[model samples]
Target: MAFIGIDLGGTNVKGILIDQSGEMLRQHYLPTQEDADGAWRDNVRDMVKYLQNYWQKPLTAIGLSAPGLPNAQNSCITFMPGRLPGLEGFEWSTYLGLPTYVLNDAHAALMAEATFGQAQHCQHALLLTLGTGVGGGILIRSELYQGLGQMAGHLGHISVQAHDDERSVAGMPGSLEYAIGNYSVARRSHGRFSSTWELVEAYRRGDPLASYVWLSSVKALAVAIASLSNALSPERVILAGGITLADDALFEPLRAFLDVYEWRPGGIQTEVVQAQFGDMAGAIGAAGFARKQHVG
Candidate 1:
């Protein structure tokens, strides 16, 4: 049997066709057009059609990894920012004409890691994705926790400091996203760099401003992780997305920061590691979810 997984981002739409054993048989990618209104749903429809034309078997189910909170029924998006404008009222399951499941992109990444990546055996885990923004998902007892109104795991919006120079639209002062997210690093360093890769390279070469920005960024991330460690008390905290790939310069400082500051009764000992699946975690997790749903 084949399952379809769609990872929709602001700039690209990535679709994957995977089999029961979590092997990707085919893949598709398309630029996210800004001029196409309601393009979010349209892009997905196109991808589905494209995959169907390439695959010999019928797709069993479709799983979507979107950027905002999925509605209670898991058919549509409820809260999304300007990047995804028409999603608030779009019915993805109906549009796709398939048994569909929609989850926040971060939540999808968390699911991906928990099912087949780094957190496979862990009962409690937290997955943090640092991209254009910082996004997070918490799993307790192997189930994704969607708090009241399906807005529970908005970890990136949490306020880390009142006087933080970086403030996000979520109204939280010094939000983790504002300080540690990819954009935050570039903005803080006053570099014209387009992406975190440039910042990481500059930091590696001992650029003073880049080093300062990188350290500050990791410090902010550590602060947030420490707080999450205390609040969730998860067995492991997995870091995914582009920024986490900054290597030891980033992870080492983060680990050291956690070692000194995490508040826990037994001396704060949560294992922190990079996500095993890297970018494919979403597609793998979506396929796993589809397989589980098909069996259940």
Candidate 2:
């Protein structure tokens, strides 16, 4: 059987066609014109139609990954704001004339890992995408754990420092997003670094300020991971996004801090690993989800 997955991102709309074995048959990309009066949605619809025709065969399932909370029914995105203006509450299934399952992009990314990437076959796992902002997803018993309002995976918004005054985009005070996300790198570095890359470069050169700022962010991340481990008790924690590219500069300190902050019972600590898929994870994951939902 064939399945289709489309990821609606701020910059691009990525679509993929995959077979039952999870092998991609074809892929396409279209610019996501977020401000072009819902043109992006039309592009997605057209893309799906085009893919359906490519094989001249019926598609077993379809799924969409978008940057918002999917409604309980998975028919539309319910609460997206400030971008993709017409996305909120838009019924994709009705528009496409097909049963289209919708999911949050972050969740879709995790689904990619769970289906075919690093976390494949993992019954309980967690994923964190550390980029412009932090985002994540949870898996419980091999199913995505989308809690009330589909807000369970908004890990970046979790507060790591209760006394700090700075707030994240989600109105969280001293959230993990603010501590390590690229959005707050400048402020965290006192205007010395505009990006995490620059800060890491300086730290490589033994810059004191850079070392302090970078280590501090890593420490906050460790604290967040430790707390999450205590609550979720996942066997593994998968890290994704551009930030993980920092390699040892990020992981080395994060591990060191985890040793200090994490409360591992019986000395069994959760394993931390990087994600396998990169930019295409969301689309692939959406397809994986569609396959699962379709088969059931």
Candidate 3:
């Protein structure tokens, strides 16, 4: 049997076709084209149609990883704003005509980790997606807490610093999102570098200004991790998304800052690690979800 999954993001739409054994048979990608009218919905239709025609195989089930609060019925997007213009309140199943499951993209990423990556078999963990925008998911006792509003694991909104009057659209000042998210990094850099990668590279070369901005982000994340640890006591903190590609440059300082900041009841250290899977995590997790729902 084969399952199909889609990971819909602000910039791109990615999908996968996977066999029952969890091996990817084929993959697809298309620009989200948030700038183009109706492109978000159209690209998905194209990908699904193209994949089915190319493989000459009908999917057993389809799963989607989308942004923001997907309605409980798994049909409409209720609260994702500034993503795709027409995404909010859109009925996905009606548009696509498939037996579909939709979940928050962060949830899908964490589920992917829980099902087959570093977090497999772990009873409690937190996964943070550090990208152009930050996203997060929580696993407790081996279950993904989808929350009543489907917006529970929004860890990035946790405030870690005081930015005076500055705030994210979520209205949290000095939020982890406003600190470590790619947009925030670039904004705080004041155009010293056009991209976060450039800032990271400059930091790697020991540039003082770059170090200041980078360390502030590291500290803010450390503070957020500590707060989460004190409240949830998760066994591990998993870092995913594009920023983790920085590897040691990000983790080493993050760990050091976490040590200084985290307040644990027994002086225990929470293990921090990188997530497995890369660009494929969202698609893989979405298919994994469909496999569980349809096959298991």
lDDT of each: 0.79, 0.93, 0.84
For 226-290, candidate 3 gives per-residue lDDT tens digits of 89988999999999989998888899999889878987666678889999989878888888887
How much is the lDDT of residue 294 in candidate 3? 70
10 residues in a row with least lDDT, candidate 3: 160-169
Please identify model 2 stretches exceeding 4 Å from their true place.
none
Say which prediction, candidate 2 or candidate 3, comes out ahead on TM-score. Answer: 2
Tens-digit lDDT track for model 2 on 1-296? 89999999999999999998888999999898888987998999888988998868878878899998999988899998887988899998889987899999999999999998988969999999999999999999999999999998999999999899999888989899999999898999889999999999999999999999999999999999999999999989999999999999999999999999999778899999999999999999999999988664
Which regions in candidate 3 have their CA more than 4 angstroms from the true location?
54-58, 264-267
RMSD of 1: 2.5
Sorted by TM-score (best first), the order is 2, 3, 1
TM-score of each model, in listed order: 0.89, 0.97, 0.90
**lDDT of candidate 1 over 67-170, digit per residue (tens):** 77788777777888776777775777777888888888888888888777788799899988888888888898888887776787778888777787667877
Measured on C-alpha atoms, candidate 2 has an lDDT of: 0.93
Ranking by lDDT: 2, 3, 1
Considering TM-score, which of the candidate structures 1 and 2 is the better prediction for this target? 2
Q: Highest TM-score: which candidate?
A: 2
Cα displacement (Å) at residue 2, model 1: 2.8
Give the best candidate by lDDT: 2
